[model samples]
Target chain A: MMTTPSSITSNELNFLVYRYLQESGFTHAAFALGYEAGINKTSIDGNLIPPGALITFVQKGLHYVELEANLESEKFDGDDDFSFLQPLDLITKDVSELQ
Target chain B: MMTTPSSITSNELNFLVYRYLQESGFTHAAFALGYEAGINKTSIDGNLIPPGALITFVQKGLHYVELEANLESEKFDGDDDFSFLQPLDLITKDVSELQ
Candidate 1:
């Protein structure tokens, strides 16, 4: 019954990815991504987010989307057959397509 | 060049997943998964793992696999066109298959 927050902007997501890359020690990759995404322009404080937050949020979002899809289709019988989603698929695909 | 630790066992992974579910407030799901995975029998100290550790480890592992793929194929020319893998895919698929 967890709901995905509607307020998260693409910029925020980009920042999170940037921070995640940095925290994970992917310095070159982080630099490239941050430069392309203009992460420096964002005002969000990087310190506020703990390490591993991006993946955590994405995982939770995927779960919520799956739950929503199951609920809408009336297929959630507690069978625990939830299909795990790729992070990009969860972000890009429609909920109906996921089901 | 972070190498995936060979020391991590399936029991450790299961424990991490259980902890993740519990930390995310999916109490019933956590209980079910814990029961099925025999999480209580594991000696891993749950308190030592921070929130989001499971997803973080999985994400890092995926990245390492991707990097290894690129290196082995000699296709890594500093271009950042890495394909993101599903968490389950990372866990289930062999490295060669991922590429």
Candidate 2:
């Protein structure tokens, strides 16, 4: 069996934390960490994503997946991409509007 | 007070999980999450970091900070960067060799 690497570096760990914050849409937390760690290019498109943006982005993705699943294979375009280039619609709506 | 955002997206949550696993040096777990999420550029410098790496990394970083604190202010150049550009020395050694 292959043995695990005996050491891990701080840079690697910091990078992981950086990526995590960015992914979670914990914009404030991610920025705080990146600033402390002195890492460059830490933003997700240079925008401070709101806390709930991630959940909205995901629900919308699942909606699209379910929609695509209902379509016949022939009707589904294999080359079609479902990438969301912009923030979700929910992000644009106000909290009062959501209520 | 400003109201919090009304929704959080799934993509954001997935990113957070991926980041957590990666940051913790759970290489296998991080890859699994990344694969399921269809995220690209997920690896830390294209290598699978072993478990226990994050702990070691942090310990080493603390060692540096402590060392720096012991040095006199004038002796410690303000412009000096403490960046660790390569994997820590511990990583290069084998587990048995470490003992």
Q: What TM-score, over all chains together, does every model reach?
A: 0.39, 0.24
Pairs with backbone N, CA or C atoms under 3 Å apart (clashes), candidate 1: none
Model 2 Cα lDDT, one tens digit per residue, A1-99? 112333334554455455555675556555555655555743223233233332332333333222223232224445343232222232232223322
Interface RMSD of each: 17.9, 17.0
Clashes of each: 0, 9
Query: TM-score of each model's B chain?
Result: 0.63, 0.36
Worst 10 residues of 1 chain A by lDDT: A1-10
Q: In candidate 1, how many Å is residue A82 off? A: 7.5
- Model 1 CAPRI quality: incorrect
Which lDDT tens digits does candidate 1 get at residues A35-89? 5567788877666555765555444444444444555555635544545554334
Give Cα-based local distance difference scores for all models. 0.52, 0.39
Candidate 1, lDDT over the whole model? 0.52
> How would you encode candidate 1's per-residue C-alpha lDDT over B14-70 as one tens digit per residue?
566456556645555455555555778877666555676555444444454444554
